[model samples]
Target: MTAPQRARSAQPALDRVDRRILDHLADHGRSSIADLAEAVSISASSAQRRLRRLESEEVVRGYRAVLDPIAVDRGLVVHLAVTLVDHTTNTVGRFERHVLDLAGLVSCHHVTGDVDYLMRVDVADVEALDVLLRRTLARLPGVARLTTMVATSAVVDRVTQV
Candidate 1:
């Protein structure tokens, strides 16, 4: 996973201590407050306060445990470029709602140019992928066309740095 990225434009500027705290947490979300304080050369209470502020400001959204897809029988990763038959607001809304909870979907991005949405799907194998595409994805509302590609390798997967 990449490091936690710097706060967005609307957020207040992060000082050196805040950056250190974020950097440490990005690498080790499971670390205790004492550990974080020690790493950032601050007190435990200070670390807690800073973390609270970050969370309240929506800077630190949440923490998650990263899992290995292969270990979980979801090794196959496919990218789909989907084009919608129409761009009506209602159609797009329905389409978005439909894909939001798909079982194997990892990410969905509303994109510009040739495609309406780009999706990352993970499954056990090509056979499973075929079933998903043929039975479900291809039949999704507003879907007019789709181009699929399987990923052979991943070169980088990191959290953005502070």
Candidate 2:
């Protein structure tokens, strides 16, 4: 998966210690305070305090274990570009609400393009995808069109440190 492009305005300046801490955590979220402190050349207590501050400030949101889709029986992954017939707020809200209800939807983004929304969906096979497209997505009110493209492979899937 490609990293979501972040706006430059949303980023804040990082001190050297902050950079080091982030780099260490990026390499291993399970790293203990002592290990992180040693890597960053700081006291364990200091490292713990810094970590707490980062979490409190929403810099470190949460940790997750990355899983293989095939192992989980959800191998077929597709990207869908959706365009709504109406651009009204109510219509968009209704569509978004319905999209959120679908089980296969992994991520949805309101983007700039011919399509108003981009959705990432994962299913077991093409049959499930057809059901999702015809029954769920196509049935959405005010939906003009939806274009889907299956992903063959993920080239880079890394979260930026900092």
Candidate 3:
């Protein structure tokens, strides 16, 4: 209905302390308040207050345990590059709605260049991936072409750092 209200600038004004807190939290999401305080060289109360502020500001967002793909029966990782038929808002919106609801989806980016979207998904195996491609991804709204690449192994798979 309406465009998102973006911040005044691209980057948030994070001081050294805030940076340290974020960096520490990025690596250790389940760390206690005392642990975080010690890591960032701040008092427990200060660390807590800052963490609360970060949460309220929607910077830290939420936390969850990172699961191993093989352990979870989702070891097959695939990247799907999508080329849309056109760049109409209606088409893109429809596509996004469908994509976000897809099972096994890790992430999706509305990217630039030759393709309209670049999406990463994890499935049980090749059969599951085939179904996702043929029955799901290929049938999305305004889809023109689909290019897929299955990851053999991850050389540098890690969570994003602050």
Residue-level lDDT for 63 in candidate 3: 95
Best by lDDT: 3
Question: How far is each candidate from the true structure, as Cα RMSD in Å?
Answer: 5.7, 5.6, 3.1
Q: Residue 31: error of model 1 in Å?
A: 1.0
Task: For model 1, name the residue pairs that clash.
Answer: 1-158, 1-159, 2-158, 2-159, 3-159, 3-160
TM-scores for the candidates: 0.83, 0.81, 0.87
Q: Write the per-residue lDDT of candidate 2 for residues 15-133, one digit (tens) a residue.
A: 89988999888868989999999999999999999898888777888886666777775778888999999899999999988888888678999999799999888888899888888
Ranking by TM-score: 3, 1, 2
Candidate 2 segments exceeding 4 Å error: 1-13, 158-162
Best candidate (score: TM-score): 3
Question: Lowest summed-lDDT stretch of 10 residues in model 2?
Answer: 1-10
Displacement of the residue 86 alpha carbon in candidate 1, Å: 1.9
Model 3: residues with Cα > 4 Å off, grouped in runs: 1-6, 9-12, 159-162
Candidate 3 — which pairs collide?
none
- How much is 35 displaced in model 2, in angstroms? 2.8
Off by over 4 Å in 1: 1-10, 158-162
